[model samples]
Target: MPPGITTFAADAPTLSAANTGFMLICSALVMVMTPALAFFYGGMVRVKSTLNMLMMSFISLGIVTILWVLYGFSLAFGTDIGSFIGWSSDFAGLSGIGVTQLWDGYTIPVYVFAVFQLMFAVLTPALISGALADRVKFTSWALFITLWVTVVYFPVAHWVWGAGGWLYELGVIDFAGGTAVHINAGAAALGVILVIGKRVGFKKDPMRPHSLPLVMLGAGLLWFGWFGFNAGSWLGNDDGVGAVMFVNTQVATAAAMLAWLGYEKLRHGSFTTLGAASGAVAGLVAITPSGGAVSPLGAIAVGAIAGVLCAMAVGLKYRFGYDDSLDVVGVHLVGGVAGSLLVGLFATGGVQSDAKGLFYGGGLEQLGKQAVGVFAVLAYSLVVSAVLALILDKTIGMRVEEDDEVSGIDQVEHAETAYDFSGAGGGLSTRSTPPGPGTSPAPTNKKVDA
Candidate 1:
């Protein structure tokens, strides 16, 4: 075992059944978020590209799960090599580990810990799919995420969570994955979008969400799952830290949703379901890193700030000319940065760890650390994602052809559609006939003419 990991004697009660059961449940909850993400992004895109959007998030579960077991887990949580990465083969194939052996500090089985972290590895890259919606090829996207998690995510995970990681050593206060997951994925989304270029008629065309109800459902699932994402990080249910994080998570998300609605009423002159969903997500992302450190009041401040800031930030793509199709950059990146930084200002050091923020008389020390963590992850992910996208664009191609894009990615790529309206009765249909040469496709907004 790596240093500081103590294996219990054969007779000792090595596992805490409560913590193990809790973590297992938490892992399952986090796993659901990816599909929920598919629904979330699926509802936001044009009707033609909905299934492709859902597929983007769904495929990650298949791809990352295999890779994580093979070597991804080893590279992420194995013995530290230089504070930048874990040993690539130490835990390869989960070798040399037994069932009774416990993970380093947690009382749960090692495999349990591995699976919990695997959920994170799976979701992080999937988060980027929202920004590249409607244009990317499924195979190329799969390839990109495979490479991205291997090169970008694994090392970063080590940096933030691995033993002797530089950021961990520096006392950067990322209780969960403010930097490793959200900022990393968000920056990567921006990078890939920059290289892949805009959708055919990004600003000119109307690309409103096809199903706000679906988006709301997805948002509800995400909110439900996030309790595990945040509180489960504590690894044990015995600690009061998990309870604090749970309460903070709830209040922060509620505050953020309200804050976003408030902002929308003022800026857009209307309250929108999309706004509420987006606001809740922003709050969830912001609180992921800081919930373990901040108070309920602090969580409100963080959520409110993230809601307003992300609300405004989503429009930056228009001004800057980047096609972040579903506003991943605005919500995840901005929210992650807001939460990570705010921890330095609001951390009370009483809930989980003994790290106080500036407002708690801790000065600017924690804030500076947070900034370094954020910038490092952002710069690294951006550059790496851009390079991967450019390479894919040069080779097998990153985007669909113009005709395929206009026709629909689902039809061209997956040979299917999300919704069909061509049945005899006024009910849903599964059959979708591809448009023939020189024939126009059906109007996306039209229901079956009953």
Candidate 2:
């Protein structure tokens, strides 16, 4: 029992073996999402850039973990400072804490909560990597992650979920990470891409996913892990709020997948594995922030709307001429916005809190609060992330030389390729060496899986 926790002494919290174990499992599940995203994004890039895409997401796990242990957790979950950031003496470097000590007033130990949230921090920066795939220098991207998390993600998490943080105090209602994770990452992706510019030969080259099977596998794993990601946010399932969130997660994700496939079939003439995977992710993103608040039926509505929205939004990159190599902006950004705003309409007062949504007779007030949280995060992440990217670009250079990009980033940057073709008569590609900039593409059957 630390002095400042200030829980009522009579009903003082005790460590719940059940919840502590549950959260540990949840932390592991959430941690898996970074690699899951790696697989998902890796399969979506051209075979030449696959390893770099995978490494982009994988690197976040290493960088954010050390930072989180040192001070990231304190900045996020520590006591509030002027409603913007947080800090606690004991949380710094995670020192001076007892193993048995519960987090604030929760039944789980402080260590459990810190690690669980650390997984989220790891995943969020990785989410931005997809948009910058193929072109960025690995070192610059790594540095960007280091600085971006420190300046952007930490403070944003504090604002949304930290105790006494402004949004938490004002009741903005992000059950998990609608605004914090998805929107924050999406906006930051847009910002950095703007600074870095489009991938070379953006539209002229027919860039398609290397492997849809890998993408599907990643999506399946993500869906499986998200149950823990959403439900586990409640810290415990004792009161049934976590249970409701679990059900909503399933329903919304299913609805979003179906809806996205339907849109793809009607608009593009065929349903795709890519559509299924992307739709499922759209649903997951949409439900992440609102699952604990919306009814199962409302989850369906939320998923459907978001699925269609993200499907359509993906095309905007082509139309707008931004090279979001993957659809991070469309799926995560648009889906996050829809989900966060939908909370105001779908929330049932009897659920997570006593706040009702518009459809449930709550009126426009909760909607307004949700908007504030949404825009504040979007604006802050976008502006600050762009500035960070710009600074990195001007100083150490963010993108590889255009010739290196044309030759394949993996070979140029990492000195490795996803596949070894030395003994197979240079499988698929004709030239023993990679083609340089403006070189004609190798002859191939156009698979275009995505």
Candidate 3:
């Protein structure tokens, strides 16, 4: 067993097996968050490309599933090469991992850990697709994800989580993934958006959601699945993990929901359900990194701060002229940063069995370490993602044909629509005129079957 891992020796075998089983369930729970993400993003886009948006998430599920089996797992968690990346020697090629412990000190099945981590790998890049909705070709995104995961995502995951990783050695506390998952995905999303450029007719267009109910449904699922996400980080069921993460998740989400609504009431003159839903997600993202590290009060602060920052960041695209269609950069990138940095100050001792933050009198050194880690992730993700995006854009093209875009991606890309109410008494004849200048209809009703 790992040196610091303490348990009754007589209970070791049973508890370890139970923890493995629990984590398997947890990993499956986390995977559901991606489809949930599909709904959340699908409901926010123009009617023309709703199915296309969901396809982005679906595409990741297939592509990353394959890649994770091939080398994605090894790259992230395999034996360290140089404190920068992992060697591929442990490439089990789907069989390399099993219900056996690989790390020297850990007790859970190595495969359980690998699969749980793989869900995260699959979803992080998918989370970025919200920024370039309705424009990028499906082929381009597929190729881009292939390359980006290899060059950008895998190495960063190694640097943070893998044994002998630099950040892990530096005593940086991720608990979950403020830097690796949320922040890395967020920064990479920004870089790709910049390279891909804005979606057609953004800001001036009235790109309202086609279905508010879908968004709500997605939010509900995410909330349900997140319990596993935050708690599962422990790799086991224990008092410490249950105590800190449960409370942290609850309070942070609540605080963020309230903050987002409060801000909307002040700015837009009404409290919107959309804002409340969005805020809840914002809170979840912010708390992800710090959930296992902080107190209830600290969780509140993190959620409130992230809520305000993301609410403001969503408007940045309009000012800066990038078309992050569903606010990936605004919510994930900004919220990730808020949570990560706050953990530098608010982390209480004993979440991970060691470590505290500057606010708890651990001094400015820990905070500075966090700043370095954050900047490093942002810079690396930005540079690598930009290069990969440009390469894919040049090779097979990125944007769909102009005609296909204007006609709608569902018809052009998927050959189906979400709603097939055609020929109904209240449907065909009531077909409203297509929207015009300064008016973009909500996303077309099209479910992504994948």
Candidate 4:
């Protein structure tokens, strides 16, 4: 019934209602990723701040959803202006979207496309908060998300996805959001880490993850949700979408997994579940940029390389002393760069006309373009995120009170504890405790008289 459905009715374009329905399901699958992220990051942190960490992911779901509905969709997807960003028309307040309205050439309703894209918008920024974990003020973080989403995320999304945007016009291939999502978030994470300063007792503390099982669960969810992520980019049900993306995802992840375990076995004397999960994610991130463009062989190389690089990068914080907490810089930033660059080198036929990589004799032109795009995003994100972090730090402050952090942010900020094994009354409290409460008991003033 929608306008565009008729365009594909005669030949059953892959972009039919069935494809749209699959994509909608895919969107929901992607939406689950943030909560999965919550669990992933939550388990990686100390138990005391678990809920606060989860709250960060949860808040993104709520805040970014509203922001996208308001104007983000328009900025990212509406008609392009000057090939940088989009110009607003129909999507302000979701103005014209309805069940009868199809989106561009897709058979699904516009609302389906909007919701699927919204999940990506929400998760990208949420990824950065991990770098600033246990340090940021909740209110300030909320404000930062609002601003960063507008400036960094919206424009990048437009450039990559919008019809008239430069990257799209230039024939750069990003099946999903390697440049827009992972690289952008990864760069921003580094900037925030720089501005926020290191967490208290960074090198002095052991700072091991409180629970590994939760981390594994989070990884599983991300893997499942990513099917929607990489595959859904096709926006259709053709064999190209089903076969190419599917095999690329599988082979790349498999190669990355092997690479990670191999590195760990050689270095640490044990292949950890953490390594397995991290490798899988690294592979996923690497494949994301090049999946639609490269051969299965190319994907294996990209993913395996990302796994090794990301694994190496995780140690950079310790060596360089940046204290990126959960290694957002190491995994996302490093892995994203690897993926983006490899795409420039390994892109095969039919993905993009002007932008095949070096392997196919496309020359350095495509590779140069890819490099420019990567650097442009990296520089812009780093500078903007640093400025934002400093402003938030100076205006309202970024770090929690030391005592509150020691006591745990779950109780201090959210008023809820992640665990309730003691069956205590604290679990029943309807209101959250203000940060820096009576926990740890006030130090007695008694002093030894000299």
In candidate 4 the C-alpha lDDT for residue 328 amounts to 85
Q: List the residue pairs that clash in candidate 3.
A: 2-105, 46-442, 46-443, 47-442, 47-443, 47-444, 92-96, 418-445, 418-446
Candidate lDDT scores, in order, read 0.90, 0.90, 0.81, 0.82
Tens digit of per-residue lDDT, candidate 2, span 237-258: 6889999999999999999999
Better of 1 and 3 by lDDT: 1
Candidate 4 to truth, TM: 0.89
**Candidate 3 lDDT by residue in tens digits, 1-450:** 011133565655442667777888889989999999999889877777888999999899999989988888888777788899886565647564444644334556667777788888888889889888889888888888888888888888888777788887786667777889888988998888888787666766677878888888888888877877788887777556755786898899999989998988899899887788889999999998888878899999999999988898889988988888888889988988888888778888767645678889777777777787788999999888988888877878888887787778878878877666656753434436777779656456555322
**Ten contiguous residues with the weakest lDDT in model 1:** 1-10
Give the clashing pairs for model 2. none
Mark the 10 consecutive residues where model 2 has the least summed lDDT: 1-10
Where model 2 places Cα greater than 4 Å from the true spot, the runs are 1-6, 424-450
- TM for every model, in the order presented, reads 0.93, 0.93, 0.90, 0.89
Using lDDT, rank the candidates from best to worst: 2, 1, 4, 3
Candidate 2 accuracy as lDDT? 0.90
Name the lDDT of candidate 1: 0.90
- Tell me the tens digit of each residue's lDDT in model 4 across 267-308: 899999889888988998889878888888998999899999
Task: Report how far residue 318 has shifted in candidate 3, in Å.
Answer: 0.8
Name the weakest run of 10 consecutive residues (lDDT summed) in model 3: 1-10
